[model samples]
Target: MKNYLSSSQMTLRMFAADLLVLSSILSAAWCLSVLNVSVPKTLNSTSGSCLLIPCLFNISKEKQNILDSSPEVTWRRGSLWSLYDTDGFTIAHRQKEPVMEVVGDLRKKNCTSVMRNLTSLHSDRYYFRIQAENSGVTGTTAVHINVSESVAEPNVTVPVLREGEEVNLTCTVPAPCPSHPPNVTWAPALGGDVTQRTHLNADGTQSVSAILNFVPSVHHHELKVNCVSIHPLHREDRPLLSHKVVILNVEYPPKETWISLTGLVWLGDNVTLTCQSKANPPAVHRWFMKRAGVEEELSISHVLSFTAAHENTGEYICEAQNLCGAMNSTNLQITVLGISFTAFLSILAALSLIFALLAIAIVMIYRRYKEPIRSETNQDQNIYANMSASAVKSEQLQSKPCEDKNTCTINPVYAFKHDLPDENIYANC
Candidate 1:
């Protein structure tokens, strides 16, 4: 009978112990439910970097008055099941030394926390806990953290572009997170020509892509095409995270060609003329000269260098061409400071030839006229001498009027006059 009585008393004491423990648990639950914490369920960040978590706490206004003017906030890295888990370390605390470092103000009811030096191994949930001093109230919230490796530059695929042909530049990058992906933007943005899309990856990630489409021209040659990613967890200076840039390999002919020559060139001076143009397939150049409205091809190269002289002076032109067509530069008039010695000698030789021809013509005419004038004067003098002799003979014949008729010849003057057939000559005799 005494053993039965002792067992009954022990049973009662055990029941009371159970009741007291249940009462204490219920009171704690009630207090915790009143102090509520709100925060996002999931957040993403990059590995080897920092993460900022937004948090807020709410409690009855009555409790606010009762609590200490200065409340305390703490952050620890653990799951909800490990509320009192001492294995978890405190990363941040209000008015106390932080685990690493925090960069926000909590006095103004900002419960935001910053996690630093995070890695893929840090892929765990964190909890925020707040203490209202003397009010015997506290709130807690959970934050699921996803830390991924830093982004890599996008893969680029671009084909060589032919003139007037359409082409595309494609770039792809692995998404930073499955829930939160980075945005893609093209460098030197092409309006209405950019295309973007995304694909789901097997490892709970996404692959984002962008493409630029256009018809290539010579103007597009050597231009850089870039695909840039803007990351959510990037720093201020490094807002853009990953990128890929490639030079456009477009092919076309020469354009806007031109030649350049020194102004006011002088004779015997070293001269250089350059042929310049914009082209994709690199234009082959040649130099030319235009004189007397005629073209003279000079060189088949980009530059023309020579010593200046009168012969070299003219309208100089540079012709640049590729597979497409020919392009000519504006004419540049090259003038010399003075005439060269060779030019002076050439002029003197021409003048000497003309003078020699004129002198030969004058000598030929003088020789032809000198003989005729001299012959005519000799004939006139002989005629005058003959006439004088004839007159003297006629006087003698008249004085010897003849008796010897048989042997007499007619007066020679009379006989000559009979044959003369001129009345005036007969009277003179």
Candidate 2:
């Protein structure tokens, strides 16, 4: 902390010693300049603006303390010899009541003066003089003031361009200072070629212009073109840039059109069909119906709404048209079953009537039953089944011993249904 304080004090002491030395030198120079005069060779500013001319004069060190008394200064437009030799003199500065102001404090040996509303007529060699209480000093050197017009930003013109259309863009800059005319450039590097020329405006001002011609496409939409000005003034800093924007409005027809329905449209229900499309300039829609090989325009609106019925079943076409172009959608088949709640109730009532008649007929047939026809063979079989069980016995045979081994004598009884009832039995004859 002690070292820091010591270093701070040393820095302040050194600054004070340097300031004292500079004041002594200035004081000596002020006294010496009284014998001579000093002025700049040239100074420049724009016309209708202010000019700062650099000058220096000196007073005695004793008189320099009372500089607030306001030293008097004069600016003469002609040479010293001519002004003294000629009777008439053009005075540019009188200091108190004139527009020209002396910004320098005369006691400090600074005699810089400002000239306001500079014009071409004021571009002449001038002399500065300082008048004290009893002594006067005149400048030996002449200061030449050159007044010219200021550099201005270029005007960029971009026309209303459309796709595939030929267009031109122009950039204009006023060249009042023709020797230092500003160059104009466009950003995004447009067109066939950049053409430059100097032309005269109606107000008699000369202007330098650059033109760019091109055939604008859809890709150039909503883009900005800049007109830059490269001037010698503050060239190392940044160039002046101005821009004009052109937005293209492209025209195209409707495409990819389709229809949208509210719901599953049935008979006697209010249904809506909306036609839509994508287009630059929006197209108006109309619904067309082709029924029974006959075509007719149905509605001239974007939405077609009606009560659905069997008669409304047809090929529905959505047509879109605009000033640019027209388009038609593919055929859409719309069919209503035409079966409503009333018709469904009527069908149920008819079915119930048919079922009731069939039931009555069935009940009458059951009450009046009739016997079926039978064959005689079945009757015989049924009678035999009712006979005694002994009537179904098989016949027996008796064999006697024979002399030869291969031959035998036999006796058989051929009686059939012997125990059966006479009405059912039959004898083999």
Off by over 4 Å in 1: 1-119, 122-148, 161-165, 175-182, 199-206, 215-226, 230-241, 245-252, 263-269, 280-282, 292-294, 323-326, 335-429
What lDDT score belongs to each candidate, Candidate 1 first? 0.69, 0.65
Per-residue CA lDDT of model 2 for 305-416, tens digit only, reads 8988888999999999876578999888888866865686799999999999999998887765522224566777778876533344321223333454443334333424
Model 2: how far residue 237 lies from native, Å: 3.2
Cα distance off (Å), candidate 2, residue 324? 2.7
TM-score of 1: 0.38
lDDT of 1 by residue, 84-198 (tens): 4343244332223223333345444456566665667777766665555554554556778787676667788888787787887788776544334568768875433888889
Q: After superposition, how far is residue 152 of candidate 1 from its true place, in Å?
A: 1.4
Number of residue pairs clashing in candidate 1, backbone atoms closer than 3 angstroms, sequence gap of 3 or more or interchain: 0
On TM-score, the leading prediction is: 2
Query: Residue 200 error for model 1, in Å?
Result: 7.7
